[model samples]
Target: MPTFTINGISATVPDGTTILAAAIRIGVEIPHYCYHPKLSIAGNCRMCLVEVEKFPKLQIACNTVVTEGMVVRTDTEKIRKAVTGVLELMLIHHPVDCPICDQAGECGLQNYYMKYGLHKSRYDLEDKVRKKKVQDIGGMIVLDAERCILCSRCIRFLREVSKTCEMEFFQRGDHSEISIFPGRKLDNYYTGNLADICPVGALTNKDFRFKCRVWFLSSFDSVCTGCANGCNVLADFKGDILYRLKPRRNDAVNQTWMCDFGRLEYRKANEARLLVPVLRENGKAAAAAWEGVLSTTALRLRDIADNEGPDAVAVIASPRSSNEELFLAKKLAAEVLKTENIGFTSRTPGDRTSDDFLIKGDKNPNSTGAQLLGITEEGFGRVVKAISDRKIRALLVFGSELSDFPDSQVEALLSNVPFVAQVGTNEGVVSRVANAVLPSASFAERGGTFTNFTGRVQRFSQGFPPRGKAMNEIEILAGLANRMGADWKFDGEASVFRALAASSAPFAGMSYESLGSEGQVVAEGRK
Candidate 1:
């Protein structure tokens, strides 16, 4: 440990911690733009200047590591003046477009300008640098050269993080601007990150352009359902409309970034979502209420179990579901419905390694969560074998587009099940085979937690209402279990999580409240 004084307050931190981080720890904020916690130190923006005792001049706090008995002052008059000067210099080339800019509300430049740049400009506004506008950087990102401060944050992000050196600074001096290599585009897996780190409106997301104003968009702490990595996120929405998705900081999971696929998954809610619960009775589909669906499904399940025994009833769980939902599905099969035939499905085929970056080979969100509950892909195969052997009659399937299976083995298993009850948001192969399809909420519309590949349990809250009358999968499962006259130990999603945490040795002391927005990683033996 190293002891240092930040703005007159003395404290001890890890040896390699930077001065800016120390200031943040002590609540003395130093304004910065290009210094991201997850990225390498760039020291390009002089906004983080701090006066150090015994040093000849002010040092960039982000690049300057704290040493034993080092003294740093960020709120001194000299430091503030230096930071103000840097801000003024940065704004000389920056366009005055905050009113129409996408990053106005949450931009680093805007925040820093208000905090450190209160002085009226003595520089001639007519002499400010002006360049091209609305230049397409790639499929998703659009660039406005006039608004760029040339901090080189985006350029450094592409080269260092994405390792895709597609972005570079072109030209020289006042004409220098961020551009891609000849004939290359910023079409990497994590290209959406540029929009998040732009500091200003120099780069904007084409998909999120002209959408709802960010201030009107309310945010919900959530997790990405796009992959098994389960990256933490904040879903921004207003009323029933979803606006955008932003990454929440989680050092154990995705760090400070999420994949483009996870970011664009919001558009999925705008189309083909099951808004209301529907029950097909006597070959006629009719709209139903929550009570009607649960009561009816419970009776039907009981009838099947009485006639065909527990072995004849099968339950299929989705990796897309939360740990609570999957655990409830299992309980419905083994306790309420009295069935041992349970299956867990995932879409990742055979790939399951982590790249140590954004893209995880496992495509589903909670495959490891299912594994924690003792449900594996191989366990699902046993159910398929039973279906093929004509031993299973009634099947309750969760998520996955069944139509994608056209002529596959899984399709054959589903087709053979006489009473196929499908519960999910999308209508696909399961819809074609099911006699009853209960509309369930998508990840965005529900509040739940998922365990990622690394056994890190994360929670995501509801961003918006379900499309129509759709119920959360956890709520639906719990409701059905209640209607079946079975004593369910849990009621709310958080309540069930206690049992999940208690039963699973890995997550022994974990709770929904403990997870909070940041989440916790399950240790080796504990997980």
Candidate 2:
């Protein structure tokens, strides 16, 4: 360990830890750009300058590695003056258009200006650098060279991680700017990551341009439903509308990046979200209140349970649901309905493993969590065989969106069941066969936890209220279990997780509070 003093606070960090990281650890805010934790250090932006004792010049904290007994001062007047001078120089060529810039409230420039900047400018009033309005950087990103701070974070990202090497610095000195070389363009599987690392309005997402101001937008931690890699994400919203998606840092999962496909899934929420519970009457869908829907749904299930016993009812859990929600579904089936034929459904391809990085083969967020709760491929096979026969009479299907399954096997299996109750965010094939249908909230509208491909459980809060009368899946399951006379005692997902960790073998030692940012995996040794 290397011992160092940052702003008079002594601390010990790993030998190679940078001064920026050490300063951050001791509550000193060092303004920085081009110093993303995941990306290689590009000491171009000199914004994280700090004064060190016995070292005359300002040091870039990002590239300055901590040494034994080193003393650093992050808040000295000399450091502030140097930082102010750098900010002024950077702002000279930068545009003063925060009103139109997409990165307004959260931009690195805004944060640095507030922390260390002169309220007045001292430039000789030379014409500022004027770049094209919005140069298309491939299909998904737009570039404005005038707004770029020459950080090279985007350029380095292209060269290093994505290995595309499309974006590069052009020319020399003040004429230098970020651009593609020759005929190549900034296009890659991980291109969206550059938009995140740009640190300014230089790179903007075309999908989120002018959609909503960042100040009005709120964020919620979530899991990417685009694939099985189960990348943890921040779902940014403006009131009831979803505006954008950003990758949340989870070292065990997707790390600091997400695919472009995952970023576009935010648009899906605005379309096809069921806002109310619909019951089929006279072969047409009709809206019904919660009291009416619950009573009718319970009566149908109770009659089936009484006549055909627990063997008659089956619950098909969705992998899109949370571990807490799925556990409640399993409990609803085995305990309340007393049916051993409970199974989870997904159109997951045969390969259900993970690569060295993100993108798990499972293709659903909580398959590991579901498997931990005792649901398995073989268990699903048993449910399929029983339903194929005339054994199971009723089915409760959750999250039946065809986009999730997109296969014929699940549809064929659902065809054999006589009576079905579909609880989901949309009306699908399951709802067509539904004797009673209830609207369940989407992942964005609910508070819950998901165990990603790494088997690390993470809790996400609801960013917006439930769409119309739709309830969270856990709440709906709790209500249904109560109606069916089950021993479900959970008041919410937290209680459900506590019970899950207590009784479930795999998660027996875990709790919700222990899950960290991006639902970092609980390391094997700590427990």
Candidate 1: tens digits of C-alpha lDDT, residues 1-527: 99988867999999899998888877888888878887788888888898889999999999999999998888889988888999888777777888989877888888888888987777787887668899887857998888887778888888788888787788888777777787877778787888888888889998898787788888888888788888888888888877788788888777888888789877766667777777776657777776777777778788888887888888888888898898888878888888878878675443354567877877788888888887777768788789888888787888845313443655666767767788988766566556677888888888888888888888888777788888888778877887878767566788888887787777788888998776777867754
TM-score of each: 0.92, 0.91
- The Cα error of candidate 2 at residue 170, in Å, is 0.7
Global lDDT scores for all candidate models? 0.80, 0.78
Clashes of each: 3, 1
Which candidate has the top score in TM-score? 1
Give the per-residue lDDT digits (tens) of candidate 2, residues 1-527.
Answer: 98988878889999899999888777788988878888898888888998877887889999999999999888888888888988998998787888889889879898889878846876555666666668887857889888999999988888778787898888787667888777878767677888888889999998888888888888888878766677778999987788889998877777789878789767756767777877766557788888788777877787898898888887777788888888888877777777787777556444454445565556677777787787765666677788878687887777765334444655676667767778888656667656678888877887778776656777877888887888888878877877777656677777888888888766766777777565545446422
**Candidate 2: global Cα-lDDT?**
0.78
How far off is residue 156 in model 1, in Å?
Answer: 1.6
Full-model lDDT, candidate 1 = 0.80
